[model samples]
Target chain A: MKRKEQKTFIAAFLLPPLLLYALFVLWPAVNAFRYSLTRWDGLGSATWVGLYNFRNILARSSEFMPALEHNVFLMVVPGIITLSLALFFAYVIHQRIRGARLFRIAFFFPNIISSVAVALLWVLIYSASDVGLLNNLLRLINPKHEMIAFAESSRLLWALVPMIVWSGTGFYMVLFLAAMENIPDSFYEAARLDGAGSFALFRKVTLPLMWDVLTTGIIFLVIGGLKIFDVIWVMENGRPTTTTHTMATLMYSKVFEEYNIGYGTAIAVLLFILVLLATMVSFRLLRRERLEY
Target chain B: MQRMLGGAGSGLKYAILVLYLLAVVFPMVWVLYTSAKSTQEIYQNPFGLPAAVTAPSAKTLETPIENFEKAWVGSHFSSYFVNSVKLVSISLVLILLLGAMAAYVLARFEFRGKGLVYYLFLSGLLIPMQLILIPLFFQFSDMGEALTRLLGPITERLGLGYLTVSLHDSHPGLILIYVAASLPFTVFVLTSFFRTLPGELREAAMIDGASEYRIFFSVMMPLGKPGLVTVAIFNFLGLWNEYLFGLVFLNSDHLKTLPLGLASISMQAQYKSDFGLLFAGLVIAMVPTLLVYMFLQERLTKGITVGALKG
Candidate 1:
């Protein structure tokens, strides 16, 4: 192809996606920041507030603080359990345990289901009705057991832990397992030859080699916890109270429901900043001398 | 004594593993079996085998069919299923083609502003969808008005009826977003993938008088199959299960996707105490992705592993 033709081809191939992305993704993202600085109902002309929305969100006893607390709770509580369980499962399955394939396949089944479906499945499990699985079990154990509404707004944050852990463990397991598999068998052999037990070998060898992927997994969990919306939306039936709202849900309700576009977009901007800071902070905190195997 | 203790330890390990396996599998099995029962039967016996399975009477056998019929037709799950299929497939095709085109150019060619373009796409990874969502909502409205203004005169002059082009509540509007939003990661992954491909093939094809376009279409894209498959699967799963975008963009019940449909049905079903319809709807929402996962478990896992390591 001629040089000009080559240039034409490049332009032709690149421009479509570039223009689309710029218009849809980049343009809107840039506009989000500008919109954050103004107070406007979505349909009306805007007036500049000059950080008033952010100030309100950052104020003492604001709704943002409790919602932010829920986000942290979601992140930390499930984050710890999911990571620990994933590591354990990855380690065990890596040891060539019996029915390893069955365990791996079955475990990952939940991860493939949509978050809405998973939330509904858990809602059924936690339902306070005769059809509720937990209530039924309780009744079987003791006839006098009163039904408990496990998914009510007040207890919803805590209830999400088991659901999150159940659905998330498999993905991280596969991630850590792949990293574990990449560790040359010779490292484990060397550790064993030096009188290290299985536990010691795992602690010293396997853990160190997979540390980078583990850090990546942690970042994923944090970001996922921060951006959690679908499950909460479904479980709350689209009316998440202040108690159950994460930043994402709050932003949605603020903009779409209450028409608080400025406040909502401000929350979105804060969320973007939070996600950015979380990713960077995680990298900084988890950064170690990269061990090249 | 030590050996005996080890045996007990391994026994306990197996026990734990088995317990977890049950925990994971049992709920899915429960949903499956419970869908076969009527709502009344479900309330009476949430855990037992449905009479459809245990007794297989002519009258009892109709329950599963009725549940599915209610979900599929009585509710709007059929339209939702079709809508999901149409939207996801169209979005996936466009994402793959456009992503591959841009990725191919960025990967193989050396040009000015290449770094700038690459970094532009890379910057998108940091911008969460939440940030863009509100603006996009308004942008769609603005764009709709702008297009209406642009097209109104032309249509009026051509003796056609007055025309207004609105992207709101349409599949094309959402497709544009899905494709555009998906391009960043698609290009990032495929750029590296294309970089790893042997340059000799391109040279050989060029020496044989093939054009750049021909080389790309014939030689590069074919060899890019594995990478394409990986990207395809990831994007397929993401777009298929996407909810937030659908929730914002689509409002009509008939236009709603599987996730949206499932969510709405779940709320209504719970309120109406129609557990059978909810269970059946859940199955409809779940079965396709479950089938895909079952078939492509190895590739799916490998894709995530590669993506994690790379990220």
Candidate 2:
């Protein structure tokens, strides 16, 4: 091919995707910053209030504070449980336990279900009515037991812990399992010869070996926790209360429902900043001396 | 003493694993059987077998069929399913083709600003979609008005009716966002994938007098199947279950995708206390991806591992 023709080919190949990406993604992203600084209802002429929205969000009485706290709770509570369970499962499965494949496949089932569907499934499970699974089980144990409204907004955050762990543990297990499988059996044998117990062997041999993937998994969990929306939205019936709102849900309601476009976009901006900082901080904290086999 | 301790530990491990397995699998099983019962029957025997299974009668057997019927047609889950299929399929095709083209050029070809262009796409990995959501909502309105202005005179001159172009509340609008939003990860993954392919194949094809386009179409694309499949599955899952974008962009009842439709139905079901329809709807929303996962579990796991490790 001629040099000119090669240039033409490259132009043709790259331009469409680049153009589309810039138009829809990059352009809006830049505009989000500009929108954040102004007061606009999304329909009328806008007034630039320059950081007032940010100030409002940062106020002690602002809804954003509680929402941020909920995000943290979701992140820390479920995040810790999911990681521990995944690591345990991955290590056991890595040891070639019976039905490892079945466990891996079945545990991953909930992860593939749509979050809305998962939330609905859990709603049925948590219902206070006669059809509620958990309540029914409680009734089985004690016929006089009162039903609990597990999906109610006041209790929704705690209710979400099991659901998040249930859905998330599988993916991390598979991730850590893949990393564990990459470690040669020779490493385990060497550790065993050194008189390392099973627990010690896993600690010394497996965890450090899969540190990079573990870091990746933590980052995924943090970002997922920060951006939780669908399940909360579905569970709260699309009207998440101040008690139950995450940053993403709050942003949605502020903008779409209340037409506080500037304030909502500002929340989104702060959410982005939170995600960026969380990723960086996790990377920094989780960065150990990379262990190689 | 040591051996007995080890035995207890192993038993505990099995117990925990089995318990978790039941916890995960039982809810789904419950949903399945619960869907086969009427709302009244469900209240009576939440944990028991539906009458259809325990003691089948003509009327009892109709319960399962009727639930599915009410969900699939009455609640418009069938429409939602079809919309999801159409939207996801079209977006997948465009994402693959465009992603491959850009990734191929960036990976195989040496050009000025190559690093800059590649990094620009990579930067998208850090962008939260929420940051762009608000601006894009308004931008669509602006774009629609501008497009209508541009085409209004031309259409008028051509004797066509007055033309209006809107990106809101339409499938095309959502498809555009899905394709564009998906590209960053797609390009990042496929670029690395393309680089690993033998360069000699492209050179060999070129020596045979094939044009660049022909080489890409005939030689490169066929070889890119494994990479394409991985990208396709990842994007398919992401876009298929995508909720936030669909919720914002698609408002019309008929135009809503599965997740949106499922969400709306769930709210209504709660209000109506219609557990059967909700369970049936949940099954409708879940079964396709579940079926696909059954067939492609290995590939799907491999894809996630590779993506996680690489990204």
Error of 2 at B154 (Å): 2.0
Candidate 1, residue B116: the lDDT equals 99
Model 2 alpha-carbon drift over 4 Å, by segment: B1-6
Candidate 2 chain B, poorest ten consecutive residues by summed lDDT: B1-10
Query: Candidate 1 residues B135-251, lDDT tens each?
Result: 999999999999999999899899996789989999999999999999999999999999999999989988999998899899989999998998888888788889999999999
Please report how far candidate 1 places residue A246 from its true position, in Å. 0.7
C-alpha-based local distance difference test score of model 1: 0.91
Please, what are the lDDT tens digits per residue for candidate 1 over residues A61-95?
A: 46899888999999999999999989988888888
lDDT of 2 by residue, A1-293 (tens): 49999999999999999999999999999999999999998888999999999998898545999999999999899999999999999888777777889999998777878888888889999999999999999999999999999989999999999999988899999999999889988887777778999888878888898899999999999999899999999999889999999999999999999999999999999999999999899899998998866
Residue A267 of candidate 1: its Cα lDDT? Answer: 94
Candidate 2 positional error at A240, Å = 0.9
Can you list each candidate's DockQ? Answer: 0.71, 0.73
Q: State the RMSD for candidate 1.
A: 1.8
